[model samples]
Every structure is written in structure tokens, then in C-alpha cells.
Target: MVHPIKVQLNDLMVKREEFEADVSLRSERLDAAGVGLHGSLLDKEGYPRADIDIMSIRTDRKRIAELTNDHKSVTNQIEKLIQELHAATKDSKPSHDRPSAPAASTTDKPPEQSNGIAAPVPAGRPVHAAQYSRPLAVVDGVSEASPASRAGIQVGDALVSLGGASWESGTISLQQIAAAVQASEGKEVPAIVLRQGETVSLKLTPERWAGQGLLGCHLRPIGDTTRG
Candidate 1:
């Protein structure tokens, strides 16, 4: 029999994923249209960019922000569930073949903590993304003075999960990540990346900077590589 809290956690995760997907789709539309939240929509001479659809961009940005807030709320609930489950497990009699529940990682060393979860990776494969069991996107470039660099995300880092967007039985879903970022602007989103054979957990706060996109980094789906 499964614990009720675990079932609740699963439901919360599903809710988070729905928020993630919605954010990704809206964010992708904004990207395709070459617009961003809080960025100048005006062109030279102070006129709105003639090539863009101003209203649609605004709508997408607004929805993304709303979803981001909702996602965070759900995540907080999930964290509380993890803690509750962890405490309960700690007091129970030990079993030789016991089940583990997800718990918050320690601030000093997130990777070493949280054994109640799944896989970890760095480059080729995520050495579970914390907030994933698989990566939907991989960090291909982390420019200087950008959010990605600030967050400790490096080149060739394969994200097992970010902003609650993930894949099933497969790896790399750029769409999920695109929505994840869109919905997570100005918010510290929990993520896990595979870095050099180690699972490095971090929080990526997508925000506006002096670079492109909220992250200022390029994420490519697995099998998609940049040509030199």
C-alpha cells in the first residue's frame, strides 16, 4: 500500500507539470515572435516594432507569469509533503527492503542528500534532474554575466529537469523547457543538471538581463548540436 502523502505528491507533481507545459508553450510563442516580458517593444523612432504583434506578446507574457506563480505554490506543497514523509519514515521501524521518500536537499551539498529520489548526471546524461527523472533540455552555452552562469550552470550540462518540465521514458524535450523558462521568469525554479558525471542540483532564476532570453543561455535538445 502506498502512503497517502506519496499519492498527494504525485498529484502535485502532475499539477506542476501542467503549469510547466503551459508556460513553455506561451514562452515559445513569445520567442518565435521575438519578444520578452519587460523588454522594449518599441523600435527606432520610439514606435512599436512594426514586425511584431504587440498584443499577442503581451498576452503570452502575462499568462506565463501567472502560471509561474501557480507552479511555485504547487512546488511548496510538494516540498512540505516530502518533509512530512521524511519525518514519518525516520521514526518508523527499519525495513531491509524499505521504500524511500523524497526530501529536501541540504544547502551545503544537495547532490549527496536526497537519496529518496532518482538518477544524477552532468554532461552526456544527468548524473535525476531533482525536480526530474530525465532531462528535456541540455545547456549548450552559458554566456558570461548571465543568469545561467550566475546559477552555476555550465556548458554541456544536461538538465534532467527544470521548472517542472520533463520527459517520460525518454530524454530531451526542448518544448517543456521553453515553457518552463517562460513561466519561471523572475522566479527561482528548482532544477537538476548532469555535470561531468555528477548530479548538480541548483535553482535557476530566470530574469531580464543584458542578454537574450530570461536565462541568456542556449538550451538544445539532445541530438541537436551547434556547428563550429
Candidate 2:
């Protein structure tokens, strides 16, 4: 019989795959509507496009959100299962087999001499654990005629930092980037991204264009499975 933990892992994997497939379907619908993955299905004037079914797209987006939540829940369950397995293994050791205390230190010895050696110093200031950077967001799709397209931004690029704010995997949201874009108005914003195996810097400008949104691209948070 398969181990219970293994079975749970398998189930989680299956759920993740199903989530990915659902996201793919949603993306296809967006593409059919002539929009990028997260791109608004609207016009330059902020009006819904006449060529696409807005209600249908809204429904698909809602379903995508539900699937995303389900995936996260399954992932958390898998993590808990793994932790339990680890704890069980540690508990399996016999109490008598545990290492005995070290023999009492030999006769109390005098304090060791400094030997003229200075204590080691840290290289830099300690950073808070919460300050670490994580996968912020990923470029899902880019409009062919948009400013982002003109700036050489492509789909699948993982955005690490934009303007002066850094994105952490679960701490930051796409709305932060949107706010930055709006604040920039029509000016160029410096952005750092991880593309493939290399890091690249680009200047992205958000302005009125022929598409719905200013940037003309779709951005999804890194925590979401719709990264493609």
C-alpha cells in the first residue's frame, strides 16, 4: 500500500495540474477576446469592447479565482502532511538510544588567552526576515501594439522590483505595481525582471494607447498558478 503521505502528495499534485488546466482555458478565452491574460476587455476610452462578450469573461475570471484558492488550500494540506511524516520519523527513535550527556568538562580550566585575535565582525547590518524578496509577479501576456511591447517586455517575465518597491512572493500584490504605473503617469519607470536565466532592466512607460489598459499587458501575482 502506498504511504499515506505519498498519497496526499499525489493528490495535491493532481489538484495543481487541474488548476493549471483551468487557468489555461481562461487564458484561451482572453486571447480569443483579443486581450492579454489580465488585460482589461475594454477600449482606450475605458469602455467595454464591442467585439467580445464581457459577461462571459467576468464569469471566467471568477471561476479562475475560485480555482486559485482551491490550489492554495491543497498545497497547505500537503505541507502539513509532510511535516507530520517528519515528526513521526523523529519520534520513532528509542529513548534509550539517544546520546548520553558529554562527560563533565575536565578540571575547571583557566580562561583561554585572547592571543591578540579580534572577534569576528558581521559584514553588514542584519536584515529582517520579512525584508527578503520573493517572486512578486509574472508577465502573463503583452499586447502587440502596446507600450510594454515597444519596451521589449515579453510574456513569462517575472517582475522582481518596480520603481522603488520590491515584491515579495506572498507579501506584494499586482495592485502595487498598478499603483506605481498610475503614479508615473506617462513617465518611464525602471523595472527589474528575471527573464529565463538572466536578470534584465527595462524602462516601461504607461500611457494612453490603442488598448484597454495603459501598460497593455497582463500581470499575475507569483503566488497564483496563472503565471503563464
Candidate 3:
């Protein structure tokens, strides 16, 4: 079944593409008029440049400026939508299902230092949980009978956090994810994702399977998605 979040995402993608196409049209119009986007409208003596169609370029420039501003507004709207989607997802989940950050320990014992001092837990997810788990990567492909598949991570899901490698300060790299999985080895590592707009937390134990990668999934940078 098509997830509502995925449906909304598809609609947004189509809208962004239309915006891109509109911007492209304006660019093409400028090119055809033999004028640069920021080319001086006036000649050396502060007179209007007669070589190019100044009047037409001026009109195009105004439209381009308007479109640019509108595009930013659209982008902000998209950001807000994603935030709300994730927030709703988190809120909707049961308390027991709410996954903890990397700082959390799954053991029965309290997490502590060698001297038995209680370890400090970061107030919240270092990456800012309020970001609604901004996606680190998109699951492009998932092998059947693989750990990722077993964990319920589907191919169109957006990976928000995996094990100890969620993003913070800057973007999280694929290598970091690999390292986190490798370190976990046979242990159960928490996996968080947005599947069809619903936040689903999973446990993925990276062990030997008849698959190629640790999770048997392809993760590409955010926005470079294959599935709608």
C-alpha cells in the first residue's frame, strides 16, 4: 500500500520539479536574449545598453527574482512539512517503541565509567531530535532475506539514524555508518527510519548473511532517491 508520507513526498517532488522547470525557462529566455543574469543594464556612460533587449531582460529579471523568492518559500514549506511529518510519527509511536540515542545502553546495568560514575547522557539526540530525524540517507535497494529486510526497513525508507552513527554538527557519511555497523558486529543495533512517512524503529544485527553489504541495502545521499 502507498504510504501517505510517501505520497506527500511524491507530490512535493513534482512541485519542486515544476519550480525547477520554470526557473529553467527564465534562464533560457535570458540566453536567447543574449544577456547574462547579472549583466549591467546600463552602458559605460550610465546609458541603457542598446546591444541587447534591455526592456525584455528587465522584465525577465523581475520574474526571475520573483521566482527565486517563491522557490525559497516553497523550500521552507517543504522543510516544515518534513518536520511535522516526523514529529507526528514520533508522537504517534508508543512510549516503549521510542528508540533512544546512541548514548543509550541496551544492557541491564547502568551505563557508567570505569570508576562507576554515572555517565552523562546527552540531553537529547545530538543531531537534534526536533529536526524530525532529518534523513541521513535513502534506502535505494534492499536484498531479500537480508538483515535490512528482516528489520522491516523497506527500499523507499529514509534512514534517520543507525546504531551509533546518526548525524551531528555536519552530514553523516556512508563510511561512518559502515563503521558503526562493523563495530556492532553481532550485537543488536538500533535502526531508525521513515517508512512511507511513518517513523519505524528497528534492530539490525550485522552478522554473516548471504548478502554483500552489512545490511544488504544501498544507501545514497539524501534527495538522490530512486523510489517515490
The residue-by-residue lDDT of candidate 1 on 42-113, one tens digit each, is: 997899888989988888888898999998788667656655765665456466444343465642222322
Q: Candidate order by TM-score, highest to lowest?
A: 3, 1, 2
Put down candidate 2 lDDT per residue, 121-206, tens digits, no spaces: 12122222222235476665567799889878865566665654453322266766677788876877766665543456677778
- The lowest-lDDT stretch of 10 consecutive residues in candidate 3 is 119-128
- What is the C-alpha local distance difference test score of each model? 0.64, 0.62, 0.65
- Measured on C-alpha atoms, candidate 3 has an lDDT of 0.65
RMSD of 2: 16.0
Clash counts per candidate, in order, are 14, 0, 0
User: What are the RMSD figures for all models against the true structure?
Assistant: 15.9, 16.0, 11.4
Off by over 4 Å in 3: 1-9, 94-228
In lDDT terms, how accurate is model 2? 0.62
Give candidate 1 regions above 4 Å deviation.
94-228
As for lDDT, the candidate ahead, 1 or 2, is 1
Q: Report the C-alpha lDDT of model 3 over 1-228, residue by residue, as the tens digit.
A: 655765675576556557767878889988877675887878789998878888888888888788788767765555556556666666888877766544433442223557553332232223323333467787655678988888777756778677645553233577766777888878787676776445566778887799676787766666522222
Model number with the top TM-score: 3
